[model samples]
Target chain A: MDDRSFVAAQDFLLSSKTFWTKQIYEDLKRTYEDAVARSGKTPTTPADVAAILEGDTLYRYFAWLERHLQRLKYAGRYGLVPYHDERRSVLAPPLRDTGAELSPTLEMPSYYRRVDIHQHPGGVMSDELDGYVYERGARSTTPLMGASHADLHHRFTDLVAAQDAERVLYGRILDMGCGFGKSTQPFHEAYPDARIDAIDLSGPCLALAAHQAPSRSSPKVRFRQMNACATDYEPDSFDLVTSTMLVHELPPGEIEKLFAEAARILAPGGRMVHLDFHAIDGPFARFMHYGHGLRNNEPFMQPWAEMDIHASLSDKGFTNIKVIPFQEAEGVDLENHAAWRFPWTVIQAELKTGG
Target chain B: MRISDSLILDRPEQNFFADPALDRAFGVVMALATEVYVQRDRVRALERKLEAAGIIDRADMDREPSEDERQANAEDREAFVEGLMINLLGKQQAKGAS
Candidate 1:
């Protein structure tokens, strides 16, 4: 119940997670290597990798650690859920005046409401204080990020900044699925001149995002509670449309709709870039990534990765489509680094100009 | 369209161990491990405070360890992990031989 106890408990969880990320993952990789070497056949598909590692005891422990570490992070004794729930009175008030517009009549998507995404007890949208819980829980999701978790978002924003010539003044920017505004914060700071609109299905998250922003940023960056697949914005409105770790949350059909919505709202020649999990290295990695989806309550990750993103973008008249591996941290080798990591990737495309 | 009431839903369960009790036992072990770590951290903090306030004579225990000692600590940690994961790993193949 004490703050120190809670802090210590969370710290222990983070250390355990780091152990899992490094040692357990490497051991499993070795197990996979040993399995294939004995079988004298290379795994060409996720199914092959699955067939090889599914029954192995170490593999089972690895998978169990991957799932339950996250579960314990948010829902265990001294977890973020109850900790924030206890402090709701103190924490919830500051979020109410952040200039976020709530949609009183917007219907909750069935997919969003069903599964507890990221194993956050009652989903991020259910409780008024769930946003606070998510914000705390997110700090330790990738154990490697430890105290530098915000660096990932800043790196993503920089990646987007690198591609644009007019970096100083982005006219209109839209950040879809901006949970607690972590992804949007970097954009707001980078393009202070840009008119930014951050939208998410969770009002609590939007409120927290708005609250986190500087008071003077009002009327410049508006946090709106709206769905990514459908919004009340006009066509050709946004100069730069983006989302971070959003697409993989949606089902394949919804992903298509979100792309269509982004295309429709983006101005001609506007850039649409998204940072998400994709571009996995091999079948072994793919097997782990998909298993992550099953254990982590993110059912859409595997489907999104398998979807023909290029064709989908081209279908929406997007040009200059580029899907590249994103280095979330500096000096992380995409090829050789052998720790458990999200296959961070960049998906980018530009709307075609008029003939 | 509305969110569910329970914290955990009856989704397709992922069972790593053969028996469900084993899965739960691991969870308990991890939870207990976290508690133990927290308690140790609290005690360490209390000791530091006591030393700072001149409540205890800890001059001999304040120094950093030698490089060899650090290496020994690292080996101890490695041994701990290996012991915890004993009997879980499978037999090594040719690639694993090296």
Candidate 2:
């Protein structure tokens, strides 16, 4: 298809997604509320909401639109897959010069290899240009972000920066699951002096990350193809270990392993932080979040949300653990925010320093 | 690193509606809506280009069509409706045959 055709089709999908995010989602919530009110019983869990509105036409429409709009964004005619696949040769060259140290022997995890994460046809690792496809797809992932999609990453980086007031965290930083370097770039910019090793299992994503990364003037930022759950790095190597939107992609057992890995790699009294979706507040919000996981092809999101990160971190020899809601934008009230938004939360803990 | 067939997967099937056919119908609607949007955008682009090139005045383009032109357009509109209705008509005919 022509460029204009693809652009228009994608724009239509994004517009439809905006409607689903706001109008349809609000209607579904209202219907659920009305149903609960009439039932004269307080609904407390996802099961309760399911019982009330499982068969409601509006809820069906909302869920259907959520799933299909995402599917169409990647698979059908004028989809991201076809658009990039057609021009793979042009897109593949620049990505190679990114200086990514890709590991040939690193076996792909079944959890990641099996599901097409975020409903991107081949996931980020299969195709040569899947990184480009993912980058484009992520731009409109949150319709609320609109034109300032990068603002979320920057906001997250600022939060990480504010954690250590006494010292600038520019010493031996490691970014886990740094997809295509969106999460890593902000760190590179924020901590120019820090030796940042950004790692992911997706080779294509790492290549793109390294390619889009800042110039080699300092040459501190390095993107490598490595698993976050188990990396080859020596113990106590990094001053700070962080990941954004990564933990939710991992299964519960694997997330525990990731925390252990972070604990091992991090220096004593070092910080371990992650920005991921953990459903806060009532069960209707959680019902929507888990349903989003199923529809979006992110199988691990529900499991990851249910995980007890605070206790898990404490068990892994971490102290001062904090699991709190993160406001990704300026005016996103944690207590009362409307529309379908990810429960952006910051999972932070510190390794106890050796006396 | 490698592009293996096994590494990729087809889109996971999700059934929100009870009837699979209804799910397929919604998919068709979205696909058609995307195409419709593309066509609408192209028409707008064409109109702007024509106006910019001084081939047509903005006011004149906005004006109502002549009786003959209106008659021709109405026939085209009917043909468009018929094209969409053909599938339903075929299904009805098959039901009668059965």
Candidate 3:
């Protein structure tokens, strides 16, 4: 099919999703609320919400759309997989083993190679054009983000900048799990003086990150293949260690290890911030999110939501720990938004001094 | 074997509905959504053809949808879920809480 038809199909699907989010989701939530009220018990766990609302038709459709609409979006007739597969030769140039602009050889971790991770067929590390596929898939990942999706990275960069604007720049910045440089791009642009070391397990992704870097006098960012949990950096090296949507992909133990690594790498009084899904309002929301984990092939999401991150960060000697909701775009209220949206939260912490 | 290998054709999908009738009903609604998407592409193709044939002006084609059209879009979505609920509700049992 032509690009026009593909675009048309994708747009229509998005409109359907908007309807699902705006109209149908409100219906489902009201039904759930009414059920909970009649049951006379507030749901404290995902199981509690599921026990009440799982059988409801509205909730079932909401759950089904959350799963299959995304599947169809990527694997549909004019989906990302088939479209990119057709353009393999054109997409493969960035993946060439060039003279050290990217990693010399890929060392993919066993844990990284394990799951498909967001039902992307082969995970981002395996395929040559997987980076291209992921970038396209991410566009519609949160349909609610709309055009402001571009602002998510920039908005987050500003939040990090607000921590200590002047001191934050020109120091070492590490972006863990920097997929195709989407998370890394804003940091480099926002802090022109800062030195950035962006790392992920996927060499192809790293190559794409290097290829897509904006033309400049010199490269400000270096994309490398490194697991976040275990790194090759010296102790107390970086001024800031940050990740966007990375922790939820990792297992609980791996998340803990990553925090320890972040602590190990950050200098005294340095900061670390991560943007991920965590601020679930109630058990109904939790039920939907946990179901999303299973339906979307991400096993770690529920566990991460269920994790007590404050306690974990305290154990890692991190101070000023704060996990609060983040408004991704303007006027999209973080609180009391009826439609479905990612539970965007900023997990910020500072490494304790001289401890 | 690698995940990319042809041996593994299908991975896991949503099978939350235990009842076969409910499962079939849900599948039907999904199929309906798919067909609607297909039809939408056809509509776009027809519009493009008309625009190309000099039978329809750009302004005519780009005219904003009227209030009736806007209302129809919302009502159709509401009616779709209303009709779907008839087939789906009362057919499922609240089980598997643990």
RMSD of each: 8.6, 3.0, 7.9
Better of 2 and 3 by DockQ: 2
Superposed by TM-score, candidate 2 places the C-alpha of residue A282 at a distance from the truth, in angstroms, of 0.4
User: For this target, which candidate reaches the highest DockQ against the unseen true structure?
Assistant: 2
Over A320-345, each residue of candidate 3 has an lDDT whose tens digit, in order, gives 99998999988887667888777899
lDDT of 1 by residue, A149-227 (tens): 7899999999899877578536799999999999887888888878999899998888888777673365788888999
| Model 1 misplaced stretches (Cα beyond 4 Å) | B1-12, B59-98
Candidate 3: give the TM-score of chain A.
Answer: 0.94
lDDT of 2: 0.86
Worst 10 residues of 3 chain A by lDDT: A97-106
Instruction: Considering the two chains of model 1, state its CAPRI-style docking category.
Output: acceptable
lDDT of 1 by residue, B5-83 (tens): 4555667667899898899889889989998988998988898999999898566566787888889799889999987
* Higher-ranked by lDDT: 1 or 3: 1
Q: What is the lDDT of candidate 1?
A: 0.88
Please tell me the TM-score of chain B in candidate 1 relative to the true structure's chain B.
0.50
lDDT of candidates 1 onward, in order: 0.88, 0.86, 0.79
Clashing pairs in 3: none
In order of appearance, the predictions have TM-scores of 0.89, 0.94, 0.84
Cα lDDT tens digits for candidate 2, A1-355: 7888889989999999999889998888889888888889998888988888879889888989988898888876778888887787788888777678898789999988888888887688998798899999999999977987789899988888886665465499999999898998888777878899999999998888777766333579888899999999998899999999999999888999999999998999899889999857898999889999988889898888888777898889999988889998888888987788999999888998861
